[model samples]
Target chain A: EAGVTQFPSHSVIEKGQTVTLRCDPISGHDNLYWYRRVMGKEIKFLLHFVKESKQDESGMPNNRFLAERTGGTYSTLKVQPAELEDSGVYFCASSQGHWTGELFFGEGSRLTVL
Target chain B: GIQVEQSPPDLILQEGANSTLRCNFSDSVNNLQWFHQNPWGQLINLFYIPSGTKQNGRLSATTVATERYSLLYISSSQTTDSGVYFCAVGDSNAGKSTFGDGTTLTVKP
Candidate 1:
């Protein structure tokens, strides 16, 4: 079985530009998560999805950030009008279930907004 | 939301040595795990121990949920073990995880 895989290992965009990061979770995994780690900061959760429906999005930083998982498969996170502060490593993870399961993380997408 | 605090923020040791890393959560019912973020930045699952103790080779983790704390033990550590160890506690009710800043361990050859 393959582990979680993220696209465009790294991305660079100018301020006010938009960028989308993609994540392909492990097969048959229903729980997908989006998390970010800004420079010198601990990793923080952004949102979660169970199948195609969002289970929790309490950690989303602002309205400019949007995440979606279509057909309960791959997921994408779009950061619009990216700010310099948006520069960080975006990680996607998957688990077999929403509770009491180990998480499998991807290599992470490093976003640099200048 | 739960708060997680990892102790010793950093550690450096020689190969073949043993060490213990600690994590304290504000509160937890179940669902806790230890992850090792390798040099390439992949978060690898080390243990999913929410209670009691579980051992796997040179790595073992013990979670005393009642005391709201956990311990990760590395025995006869190797260079490959150098990485950041994170402890995440999930709210059994919400299924959301709260991760600590992490304990960074550097092993010397």
Candidate 2:
């Protein structure tokens, strides 16, 4: 089975620019999640989607960051007017279930905001 | 929110040696997972062990949920094992999983 896949494995943009990262989860998976890892920091959750509706989004950093999952198959994280601190690796994960299932992660999208 | 901490923040080992990485969570969790972040920045699932013990090849993991801690054992380590090992845990009531700072393991050949 195909695992989670992300696009634009690496992105470089100037501060204040906009960049969008996309993730395609495995087929039939209902739970999708987004996480980010800043340099020298732990990976942190960003948001979660159960099908097309957002289940939780408490981890979103600020108003400049937005995430959407339309039709429940793929997700997009957009950072508008990105700041230097936003440079990091963004990961997307999916699981068959919410509570007890294993999570499969994608090859992270590395964003470098300078 | 649950907090996950991984120990021996950094480790270096000679190939063929063995090692153990530890993770401690602040609260009871319904999901606990170990992942290896390779040099290419891919998070590969190593184990999904919330309780009890599980072994896969030379790698084994044990989670004492009552004590809120987990241990991952790597036997006969190889250079390919060099990477960052992260432990993530999720509370039953939360939809998201909290991750540890990760243990950076370097296995020298």
Candidate 3:
């Protein structure tokens, strides 16, 4: 079975620019999650989607960052007017259940805001 | 939010050596996972051991949910085992897993 897959393995953009990262979870997986890891920091959760509806978004850094899962299959994280601190690796994960299953992560999208 | 802490922050082991990595959390958790982030930046799940003990090949993990701590043991380490191991925990009430800084392991061949 295909695991979680992310697009634009690496992205480089100027400060204040916008970048969108995409993730396609495994088939039939209803639970999707987003996490970020800045240089020298631990991986932190960003948000979660159960099917097309957002389950939780308490981890979103600020108003400039937005995430959406349209049809419950894939997800997109967009950072508008990105700041220097936005440079890091963004990971997407999926599981069969909320807190009862193992999570599978993607290769991660590395964003470099110069 | 729950706090997950892993130690010792870093470790170096010989190919034939064995080592244990530890993780401590601040509160009760219904989910606990151990992951290894390889040099290529892929976070691979090793175990979803919320409690009890499990072994896979030369790697094993034990979680003491009552004590809010977990331990991962790597036996007969290999050069390919070099990577960052992370511990993540989540409570049913929060619905999100909190990760630790991770234990960076370097296995010398």
Q: Residue A44 in candidate 3 has what lDDT?
A: 91
> lDDT tens digits, residues A8-84, model 3?
89999999999999999999889899999998589999998999999899899999999999888899999998999
Clashing pairs in 1: none
Docking class of 3: medium
Measured against the true two-chain complex, the DockQ scores of the candidates, in the order shown, are 0.70, 0.85, 0.77
Q: Which candidate has the top score in TM-score?
A: 2
RMSD list, candidates in order: 1.3, 0.9, 1.1
| Candidate 1 wrong stretches, greater than 4 Å | none
Give the CAPRI rating of model 1.
medium
The Cα error of candidate 2 at residue B39, in Å, is 1.0
Which 10 residues in a row give candidate 1 chain B its minimum summed lDDT? B89-98
Candidate 1 global lDDT: 0.90
lDDT of 3 by residue, B27-46 (tens): 99888999999999999999
DockQ of 2: 0.85
Q: How much DockQ does model 1 earn?
A: 0.70
